[model samples]
Target: MTSPSFNPYHEWLGIDPSISAPDHYQLIGVPRDEQNPETISRAADAAMSRVRQVRPGDKSQEWARVLDELREAKSCLTNQGR
Candidate 1:
């Protein structure tokens, strides 16, 4: 039998599977109304680091995509003009 699939968003980030597409704030573990760039950056960095640490070696592509999503979230939340 094949092994079960891994969902980093749910398993690693604790995001609900129902949320197929979590927003930038949700992805970064910040309040939706948070307006501090430093907080947003720090949250994003921590999330990225966490993902990097627990990433499965066989799932490099999936982890890369997650990292990209984290980067995009950080950019969108921190820039405020993007």
Candidate 2:
């Protein structure tokens, strides 16, 4: 029998699937109105580090996508204008 599917978001990041699409704040584990760049940066870095530990094996592409999302979240949250 095949193994059950793995969801990095839920299993690794503790993100709920019901979120469907998490905003930058949600993805980085920050408050929606968080304004401190340092806080955002720290949260993003921690999230990226955690995701990097996941050994997806055949799901390398999905792992890359999650990493990209974390990168984008950091960029968006740390942008002064955003």
Candidate 3:
């Protein structure tokens, strides 16, 4: 399905009929308030933790990517502190 909000393509969840004007939007997905960033970050942390638990042999680009995400998240919070 395409994004009902704007995109020429639908998003994973499906269309939301509540959004009347689809073309004006950039993309369609769950709203931030409904799917908060903190909630998403927690899910990401859990997945990364599981990977470390099962495979402690070494880290890979995937782990690095997760770390980068963590760094970015940290920056956001720290910047807010300023």
TM-score of 1: 0.84
Task: Identify the leading candidate in terms of TM-score.
Answer: 2
Candidate 2 colliding pairs: none
Report the lDDT tens digits of candidate 1 across residue range 31-66. 999999999999999999989888377777777888
Clashes of each: 0, 0, 5
Cα lDDT, model 3, residue 42: 55
Q: Write the per-residue lDDT of candidate 2 for residues 7-34, one digit (tens) a residue.
A: 6677668888666567788888899989
**RMSD to truth, every model:** 2.5, 2.7, 11.3
TM-score sort, best first: 2, 1, 3
> lDDT of model 3 at residue 55?
36
TM-score of 3: 0.30
Residue 71 of model 2, lDDT score: 97
Give model 2's TM-score versus the native structure. Answer: 0.85
Superposed Cα RMSD, model 2? 2.7
| lDDT by residue for model 3 (1-82), tens | 3223532122211335454333211122223333445654554454445434533123344345444544454344334435
Q: Which lDDT values do the candidates have, in the order given? A: 0.85, 0.83, 0.37
